[model samples]
Target chain A: MTRNETVDVLIIGSGASGAAVAWSLAETRMNILCLEQGDWTRPTDFPANGRDWEARRYGDFAISPNERARVTDYPVNDADSPMKVANFNGVGGGTIFYTAHFPRLHPSDFRVRSLDGVASDWPIDYWALEPFFAENDRMMGVSGLAGDPGVPARDPPMPPIPLGRTGAAYARAMNRLGWHWWPSDTTVATTEYDGRAACINLGHCTPGCAQGAKASTDITYWPRALRAGVKLRPRCRVREITLNEHGMAAGAIYYDADGAECFQPAEMVILAANGIGTPRLLLNSASARCPDGLANSSGLVGRNLMLHPWPQVSGYVAETVDGGRGPMTSLWSKQFYETDPARDFVRGYTLQFARGAGPVAEAVDSLAAGRLPWGEGHHRAFRALLDHRLRIGIACEDLPEAHNRVTLDPELTDSDGIPAPKIDYRIGENTRRMMAHGIARATEIMEAAGATQIGVSPTLNSPGHLLGTARMGTDPEHSVVNPWGRCHDVRNLFIVDGSIWVTSGGVNPTSTIQALALYIADRIKQRLATLFDPG
Target chain B: METSQDSGLSALEIDALRRLAGVLIPPDAALAMPGADDPDILADLLATLGRDQARVQAALGALLAAGFAAAAPAEAETLARSRMATAGPEAGTLGRVILQCYYRDPRVLRALGQDPRPPFPGGHVLEQGDWSLLDPVRARTPFWRDDRAGAA
Candidate 1:
């Protein structure tokens, strides 16, 4: 078919980064449109608690990209990678079911090569992105105390959500160990603000949030961006980026919801389709000028994939740690966040305490551990999992390595006849050593906190936090995008998602990901002079 | 027993699955909830997880043939433990489906001190809890090391 409609800018994926950019650019009176592969999930869809709500988590709301398996989604063959790609496809993307854990990247994280000496240094430092972090915090309405001395100091808009019994127990343990522990800088609102209702401490933040307390972009950025005038076309899966004679991104060819082909032309194209998704689109867009893929000048479009390997350890605390109550995880320690050469690990990890899963989930955990017996002692076996359990997740920072990557699978394709992403990754030696140290440290903490019958789980099948496929760098010969998120080969094309990450920090990437999008959007607004220049 | 329009279990398989549920969920003091073999729960399990009769028959048949249903509680527990020890993911998935069906019941939630209905619309009124526990961590300085990703 002919071109559907022409706009000043066209964005793909309406997730954290996409929403940030869309909201930022909507003000310039430019014709902006975002094409999403999935439909919008209404808040009403996720009730606080229903009979089958917990069951539905393993169903439609399942975090596994393969398990949720929406029509717009393609199965990721992650045979080699320890964790599968676990994200959603809809308007808010994975944020729809995320914990809304918001944390800033440290200044050391940006200059890792200069400071830590392992990973590549980001072209832009934490100071350059600090203002955007604060901006995002204000926009998302973060909840926590501002004086966290871990990074630079900044106050959150809302007060810290109550630590609860579980978090408090862990804090005491951290204090006993003389370690650094703090309330998480979460995106969940404590009191009602910005039209959304207050979080009622409902533990089911993952399946979905009924109260708009969680700062998923659909409820935060979409509403504002829509009001500010950005055309949103959902269920439109972009197939490839079509280029003009001058090798600039002219538009994209996509398959509409009806399985019909459509083309939307634009002066510029922004790809916020995430780490896995951004590369999937790039690899699929093969043409004459770029025989390998569109903007794959360096053949690094899908290289250096990073999924923070999280090893969760749990034990029975002396006091009740709140069985399936409050938010998922509100307390965390960054004591091991910095790399210690004495520890034999290149980079370090973080230990965050979580109130264990719901009743059904606990039962499953018990069974998986082979601790829950058949007839008698079932209750006794289950008490540690349900009530007095304090769970800690060891999140290790994964370094970028060429061998660990996402590539196109020739044997498998999605429902839309597009090649699916196949992952080939393994945790490097640095990460493994870090994980072992973290687990040992975690075990010690659990023991010190008067916990009994402590159980440390094997490495989770999937790490879940997928990042760094289309990594950014200063040189065009090595990275897919530049530090500014602009494709070095295709000036008119930009990728503002986690794909542009130079290094994966030891914490969650959502907060940093969204901030980078805002930073890039401002750059595009200011650099309008040579945006469409043929030079 | 409440029977939905869709229960893909055969009469023989249902009988076998029903018998095995008793061993899976035994009535105890703390767990005042219904047993897995309870008629309503059995029907619910059959209606939901019994979609693939072949798979259900295979797993349940293995347990029954090993005298898991008719044996004493102690003996049945032994058989189940042995079977589970030898069984693969199919057995794990089978047990998960059974436990999932058993726990979804309202009686189970009441026994666990939780409201029976879904958690939204009217949510839990949990306490802000004691803050003294956090005083120690709050009193100390942040522990992030000045070093970035240390040199390779």
Candidate 2:
């Protein structure tokens, strides 16, 4: 290793959780530093300007993690999983390719076991993260209406996006069905805040946002934290976290841009890597002291992986919906946000109405589904998918199962020769029942809205929310980390990403993920007396 | 290209594509849409599908043999479906890529009531439809669960 550098706190991965912690701890005036594997890409680097933009999406900016295997991206073995572990690896992490749908976990999500008699309960509750969620809303620049009856009371900072044609149709249907629907809290800005301009209604939020309107960490927290003296280093892929004589996290050994190994010694080490990356690092860090892996004394470091399965429903309409305009998702419903004894499943799902993709994407989508014809019939299908369609994404909540997990792949390795994560995930019975209910209800809503040609994709696609690999709980015997995000074994080592979630909530997990990181930073600051003290 | 200079295909394939391009994207003077065989446009398309040279060349061969350039639109389509389109997944993929390549071109986009420019640097300005479409939802009562007690 090269010269061992030291800092008060060293955070691995600068994604949503990492950025939240960085921003939270920046005020502490500690020597805080964050290392990100991916480069801090510029606005122009996004492929939105090219004429071959839609086609290039399948190659370079593909939503599939395996296809976009940049040097910074680690390969994932998703052979067994129904849905892929879809997350980007830059400073913004999934925010780079996210739809920016910011929804908080309901009060029921935190108390799943107590409420539903399935899955373990989170050590904390929705009330505990409520203030933090509000804090993140302002920080991330959420544009939405307050007074969403299903959600707890909290006001957004800006006005909501106009409920365009798609949202209007879906909302009218929800009204006719007497279901709960509201304008969604998207991270896209309607008005300017913190020097970032308003969202210009760009359609391709999935391939990265060039307008800087999306509240990705690179634009939101990284610059502010850097201004606050937090050193933000990129192109440094961390190999493993090292331990001291006391078996505390001493530092991390990482491969820098030049492929040279260097040790970053820190008074405290925080793992902000997501569900897959965090477990991959720990499993790769097998030493004599912790043969099973550091913080794997419970043998739960890479267990209980939860990837929310996405089932979608779509329909064709006569009116022009302007689907490719504004933010992708405009309206959402929490009518089934909680479970009922009537349903076979214990958990629930959220419905988000979005536009069908661009003309090229629609052509490919129709071809894949065997709906669109080639030759002379192509033009009609293209126009129908483009200007005359409405789509709803059903994000179902996945319960944590010990067998469905992220294990270290024995064969696959990244460009750095680091062992990649192997995902052995299959949808549980509960999720299947939930999806059936969700799809059936969504189809009815589509018909109610006078939409013809309604179709349902029952199988799962990318969940986009990867949680519960290194879960937090009250008991050390069954968990990797404690309630405060501290590793049960290593005092200074903290995991503050979706990896530490006890249960995966139905809605998007970014708001909760960021809130937990901020909560952990508070816990770390409060416990500074024993944060660095050895047993 | 002058004669598929950048395309990995042979001269015969280039000549075939030049003939088939007119049939694929016919010239429309009223809409100012040029045929797909326009040299600059064909070059761009060749560049777009360059990643799979073998598959594209196979499809081009099949289409040429199926009288794609000489037959009527429906007849040519039937001929393609019966002979070449059934070649395999590879042929179907090539056909789709070629069709998208034709449609996404600025010339075709302008014919389909769209701006000639790509959707970046500047995006579309869409009109927000009437909010009265939400009056039904706005009139409904709140449907939230009473509390966690009901769930528990």
Candidate 3:
């Protein structure tokens, strides 16, 4: 294979964590290279630019890589998993399809073991990462109201997204029931922040934001990192991370866009591939020196997988809520976000309120739900739910379980002959109980909001929050990565992604994922003197 | 069960689709909303068949084989309901495509009080709601537990 010139730092995956760390380390003047498997996404090429925008969600912009099946996407064997793997392989990664409903993990989230006594506590607490959360928020241009009593008080860079008619309806319901509800901390800019424009109240925030308002890393950090002199080479699919005689990560071998095999050497390697991608790479890079995996001395590299179980409850209100006029989630409730001893479950869920879908989606989904008939009553049923429906999506916290893991498929391989990652996951009893409670609560709220008819999607299979496959902890014997995100076995290797999470919080993980990346970058800078010293 | 060369749909199949579409969603004179088999909507649906050609063809063939075209309007409706109850892959595809195309029509969108154009450059305006609704939530004390409040 071809050998490229060595760099000081080699990073893989240019999505949320990758982009943040690259930007953080750029000021050091060290040669930093990020190899991305997918090409850049142009805003004009987003689905919103076409009349068939809603339709494209099921096609090109599908959250599942198996369904999208782009050349850059590697097939995932999720047959054994009730919750399918949802991810994007492009420059922005899953952020490209995220709804931008950003919320930080509560302080209690880091102390799951201490508080609820379920999952292991994070090596680093929420206080350790609080500053990084603020820093990443500035870079990503967060929009939210301050003093949300659920978490700590902090001002966002921009005003909170407007609580339109739909949000107002839900807010009134919460007030009637005396439940806590707050405007969601969304990453979409309310006013023009940085160089991006403000959102125009477009119906669908996923399928890529044509408005340039949503903070996908491609439009958020990647541009700033590029300007800071971070070298990014796209369309280079990494096959394996190579190790030197000393068993340190020497570099990575990847296939370029032309399908030519080449090795990009570096002094240090950082993995920013998400939970599944990161573990898949580690397992595929196994060698005689480390037969199980590169950092498998603990045998925890691909263990403790957690995919948050999200259940959606929706119903039709009496009046027009104008559901197709704005971002999906403008408000959420932390009413059941913490532990309650009386409840059967340990950790709770966040109720994220969403506006209704557009005409096509509304018609299709309503028909399936039996709310809209297929005969003469179709028009009346469709008219009732066209713009009057509202939904509450419960983001249930998933405790880490060793059996719910990502393992290399024995037979399935990508086009490049790399073994695909197979997921074996089932909703645990705790999550099932949580979902039941959450559904009941959501139905109650909808009824209080004066919804005439209600529908429940008990479980959403594609939650897109892939986390905890390579957990971080203080103990090297139980975790794949140490507190500062360094592989316990590989001295010069580090990981900065959702894969390092110890527990899945009830809110969206993008905010915490970026904070962890920024925090790890700071730690790496601080320990530059003895960065490669053996543990 | 026949297939045309260009549109991947036979003339007979297109007629069958019209009959099936009417049974799927009939015209409503009260609201002036056209059915899925409206001439314009049927034309658009047929024109857009290339988007998901193989699946749509299979679905149409299945419906036609089930004698939906040969049956009376009431009998066709009964047959459609039974097929829908089963929700087989072919029935699902047919239902989804018809509804998707039906909702895209300007008349349908207008009747639903939505702008006919795509949600882009001409995005709609949403008036902000009462921010005082959050007063109660904001008045409450912080509920998050502090894990390291007294730590050095």
Candidate 4:
């Protein structure tokens, strides 16, 4: 296992996209080598208790303590940097810690520019990606309700999870207001669809799932790829993409398990290292042939970063709703998902009614709202409120802007001497207006649902669903990747992650990311001789 | 007991944190004993408890200040109760206080009769039936040194 092995295909970063690509290519008999930066650990390793889980899951040491020191670290601030780093490393990547809400983007989302003058339209339309989306949903075993008038109908592979009290209350409120809402489409299996157990509604999907219900890529696709003879090397951090004299990607240089430098040569390379890491890697791989960075022909290797903005509005009800009993978000409303002329903002928002909170999260919420920390006053308040709170989250679509971008800081570097991702972002006027509308609507819904008193936090920026750092387009001068996720500079170098998204849809991007990976793998398979053959 | 001077904490900051923690947990006055004089010792206790003591203190102080502002003629405790009641049970002021107490107070632990060696309840516990109850160990055994290297 020296640096001499030659593989047919080398994939960097074994997250949702990488895992899907590996699984799809495993059947092609290609010698595929997938590299993951974090160590491979199972769901059984997660802590059951709240306090320990909080420390292990939310702490900076979420990854292996050694590898954790090397990754990009950003501190949180209330004013400027409100983005909390909710990302995870390892085989499954962020999927292991996500809330598992898997909603596909509507057809209109692809034509945002045509519908409104806010954002640019994606080069590939919904019709081109519809089949791949279906395939991805089927492969992931999505549990959801079909025939909701508010959204496009796609027959789910499994039935939706049973609606709990929180869901019921939200549904009633929606019905009262005549708003469009439905059971959220999630990756959790409902009836043991694909050798995985169904969700038991543990309400702790933020950390790793203990019940194996959350369909993390490691559990769903990576295992299948391994069984099909794909070689997966966990704890392998890719440093740079080495190019040949002909200006094509030759192989990747990475740090092995023992922190030793190793290089693996391949005919073709795929970078699925997410929106943030993909751009960082590309920018860091500066060389003589590519002066600005690898695939920096357009000077757009790391630009136009987009994240779905989320602000929460919560309330208290009279009934005992055990808020911490089920999956984090089981129901969502798309009544305002599509853009309207009445609103000032070009993009719309989705209202998600989900389970309340864990004990720790609830405490944090109370503290944020200005409450006394302890004593008889604290005891009386806790007893009065423990079982009656109903929480709702509003997720607003943030349209991609040229100014909000990710660039490498010349000064700051990680422990491994890699440049830190310098994010120059501010909440645009359109997004702020959309958030205000969403918060007001959410507050009205809560009040109508017999809520005694409701509390709404001011607008906050969301760190989840990072997208569009290297946007896809038909032209090479304006975009980093083509419509098929192939780099314009290097034909064999493909990127399939949120980085390729042209617009941030008003929904979770995981399903779309997997669909894009599937589409790209299919393209590679069809053009195997032209792309991968060693003449 | 280390006083504020001994602990190197400003009297205002320590007093604020102590009052906030007391409000969060509202200890039974009968059971409430005089806290250690050393603010440093109290600060160490809070740090050992592993909770966000500063944020709790700041939030509690803001709430009290707001309540006092709203009802000038009303008692401080009554105003605090009214403000707490507005949050309701799941997210009410009292529940948050109890959570803070559970995190920052050794007195709460002593009342529960738990060992303070590991500090937390589920750390390194082997007999726990639930596999999820155990703390995450990075590498249980090295692959080269393990018995099931070939089997794995």
Point to the candidate with the largest DockQ: 3
Ten-residue region with minimum lDDT total, candidate 4 chain A: A70-79
Write model 1 residue lDDT over A426-530, tens digit each, in one string: 888988888889889999889878887677775476446778888788888988888778898999999999988988988888999999999998888888887
- Global lDDT of each candidate: 0.80, 0.80, 0.88, 0.68
Task: Give the TM-score (vs. native) of candidate 1.
Answer: 0.95
In TM-score terms, candidate 2 sits at 0.92
Model 4 residue-pair collision total = 28
Q: Rank by lDDT, descending?
A: 3, 1, 2, 4
**Candidate 2 segments exceeding 4 Å error:** A532-535, B2-5, B9-41, B50-96, B128-152
Number of the predicted model whose lDDT against the real structure is largest: 3
Off by over 4 Å in 4: A49-51, A54-57, A60-80, A371-376, A458-463, A532-535, B1-20, B28-152
Local accuracy of candidate 4 as per-residue lDDT tens digits, A438-510: 9899999998888865877643533356789888998899898887888988877899989999988778889
Per-residue lDDT of candidate 3, residues A1-535 (tens digit): 9999999999999989999999999988899999999999998888888877776776677788886888889999998888887888989988898989899999889999888888898999888999999999999999998898887777899999888899899999999999999999999888998999999988789778899999999988998899999999999999999999988899999999999999999999999999999999999999998899889898988888888989889899989996778998778888899999999989899999999999888877787777888787778777788889988899999999999988999999887888999999889999999999999999999999999778886337657588998899878899989999999998899999999999999999999999999999999999898999977
Tens-place lDDT per residue, model 2, A1-535, is 7856689999999999999999999988999999999888788878677777777676667766786777788899998887876888887887787888998888878888877899878888887788888899989999888767777778989878777777778777887898888889988888898888877776777787778888899999888889999998898999998899988888999999998999899988999889889999999988999998889988888888888888888888887886666678788888888888988988799998887677677766666566665444455556566667788888889899899888888899988888898989878999999988999999999998888878876346665578898989868889888888999888889999999998887898998999888888888889887775543
Write the residue-wise lDDT of candidate 3 on B1-152 in tens digits.
22355567878788878888888889887898888889888877777665467776777777778897788878988987887757476677678778878888888888777788888887778779899999988799888766775832
Once model 3 is optimally superposed onto the true structure by TM-score, how far is the C-alpha of residue A99 displaced, in angstroms?
0.6
Please estimate how well model 3 matches the true structure, expressed as its whole-model Cα lDDT.
Answer: 0.88
**After TM-score superposition, what is the CA distance of residue B112 in candidate 4 from its true location, in Å?**
15
